[model samples]
Target: MTIKQHQSPHTIGRNFRLIAGILALAACAKPANATDVFRFEGFGAISRGMGGVATAYDTGLSGMMTNPATLSLMETGSEIQLGFDFVSTDIEVKNKATGEHVSSDSHGNNRHPYFAPQIAYGRQIGSLTLGAGVFAQGGLGTEYGRDSFLSRASGNLDTELGNSSRLLVLNIPLAASYKVSESLTLGAGVDATWQGLNLDLLLGADQVGSLMGAGRVSGSLVPVLGGLPDLRGAHFSLTRNSPIKSGVSAWGHTARVGMTYAFSEDTRVGVAYTAKSRVADMEGRATLTAIDGVAGQIALPGDITIRDFQMPAVLNLGLSQRVSDKLDVAVDVSRVYWSDVMKDIKVGFVSDSGGDINILLPQDYRDQTVLAVGAAYRASDKWTLRGGFRIAQQALRGSTLFAVVPAVPKKHVSLGAGYAFSERASLDFAWSHAFEEQMDNEGTPNTSAPIRVNHSQDNVTLVYSYRF
Candidate 1:
């Protein structure tokens, strides 16, 4: 005889709820208006206020997420930090021919005041330090309604062509640092990363025809449907408009290594390198619909996959100097290798009706160089003030497909302050403002209408720390 056991209905329901809650939390982790293209300019309040200059300075446990070597500079005890970033974006798109424009801030339904949380813990043991933390790397997104000029330009003047895109990246890192000598320290970390993407796009008939003529669109469905002469007025769309949905997600891994050396009691230098992420293909399900003057409308539900999308590697170098007993200054320079990963975006759609299609979107992004400088003044034993400025090179070589995801800001000004409430607790706050930038794209073979985008943003960070 054999005996078998099955889970009760109550247990199964409880498990289902738990899984759903986790997925919901992940889906709602949205980020916007990152300063370094789609990547944030800094990690924590102190770094943000100091022009992202954590490479050589001690900014609490948050340094573990950037230059791990700085962790060795913390006091020999246990520390916990909690923080969050609040971001606000202002973006507008215009059709030069139609003289019509749409603002990302005008849509009431558009989610604003985005928030991302950070938490970290570190412990110092003799000459070594260990730490762990969760942080949001950065992301870009925008929303426009059906009545917007973008919808009218797509030839769907009356339909709900909500053009949008949202991308979010999160990291959980385990790091360790060791003090090699009185003036030298080295560190490394391994990061587990998660990325999510959501998109809603509509392409006009002219663009669709150009993609076909250029051989950029292909698949099993091409032979069966491509030959139709009535396709002249056809349009294509991949749409999912809900803000609470992740649409597609993937997991990846990366690593970072860094070192710091003190030249004297008043001067120090640091260097760090972060490897590119190796993420899996983003996979999900969505509706792929086509509208034609002759065929009327055809909708195919399918699974979608975004292939070969990865983050770029970065190198950072920095120096810090103690000019006086109450004044300190720091500077950092970084190189971002964006050209390696931003060549082309390939989208694969496998329709439930039995055919698969592939679409190619070219980005042609260039590498970027960033420089930052900051100063901090100690007004008293309980008060400190900080100010900084940062400048970055333009990352995109062209603006063809950037109208929807405009990461164009190139300069920022920041201010911050820190207060010590007690020996064991403290508070830090920072604010950064990105200057407005505008870019114009010439008419391409796919469409004759020139497009212009204007973008700017503001970011605020607050952190609370407790040491034991």
Candidate 2:
């Protein structure tokens, strides 16, 4: 953590404290209730309003997350931007055979209307621009009450069988861009990321049997108690209320490279590649509760480890054009290599009472292709209007295990506005709505009945910026 030599000691100390504060805030933040398979469609208000298009166009300091090369396109000065997103998600899971539905909104503990904060600063020096920021990458979560069918199916009809799952990722990026020529810019960045997961889940005997039949369960418990003759009515659960208090979390790192080229003064093209993240195993403590018809119920405190969980690599290509002096249009295409990273999630549990169990949750997610298109109109000297559309292919491959962590929305529409109130201050606001999507798991191995999940989401972002 070194600051520029020209800065005074007091300034350096203040900056260090600021970074620490940012990390603390990010640690307590919740998931965004993702739109693109656990990933947000956009990063900042400017990008959200313009359909997540920032590769080829200047999008203030927030461009560090999308296309760092665009940093060089900013006005020659120092700029700071601060913003937050209010996310509202609607999710429902239904057991088609039982005709019972559980809505996330039904639970009093359901943490809806999640908030994600964003802050960034960039400065221009000679032909180079340097910037840094903290923001959320993306995440997914769901909550079901104890009275839901899932809890009843677990044979915990009277007990408080808390059922929920949450996954969150936050990123702090340090980026820089160099203007190679009047028409070309090159940039790169390094990201320090923190990822956390909390799960309070219960699995029924049939589901466990299916997993065992598929060879997805292993460890000491399997060889010992797994062979018991009366294991037919068994139930298993791992419960943790909060990630910060007692859940699995890890820190990881990644990098990005991007370049922007101007075909003409009115048209530009940008390309960016983000490498996959390398995260440590998420390890934490939870209560592993087991219940069986013959052996009754037992609760064992244990440690759990989630192995080799990582984010997918992505490639983005974008084109921006000035349709008129007052109108600008942009389109972007992105490919996410999800299959490589989301094949399966392996969890290993070790209890103090000498119980070792390994479980595999199959994701089998496919690669995703996303397309975004947006336009901005300068209505007056102080006002600008923006609108955009985005679409993506389904990533999950019909896995019944995804019922709790559904990321099913595939289409989104957004609208935004920007207002300049003074020579050095401006405000931007954007809203995005994801259409409801439903998916069914008919042929999945772990389910006795078909499971259907419906998901929809809304995001609103407001940002204020100042230039000096």
Q: Identify the candidate with maximal lDDT.
A: 2
Q: What value does the lDDT take at residue 175 in candidate 1?
A: 95
> Distance (Å) between predicted and true CA of 378, model 1?
1.4
TM-score of each predicted structure versus truth: 0.89, 0.89
Model 1, range 15-109, lDDT digits (tens) per residue?
44653453344333333668898888888888899887788988788887778999998988999887777677888888888788887752422
Q: Give the per-residue lDDT digits (tens) of candidate 2, residues 34-136.
A: 7888778888888999888888987788889988999999888999887777667788888887788988752533343346678899999999999999988
Model 1: residue 380 alpha-carbon error in angstroms = 1.5
lDDT of 2 at 154: 40
Overall lDDT per candidate, in order of appearance: 0.77, 0.78
RMSD of 1: 9.4
lDDT of 2 at 347: 86
**lDDT value for model 1:** 0.77
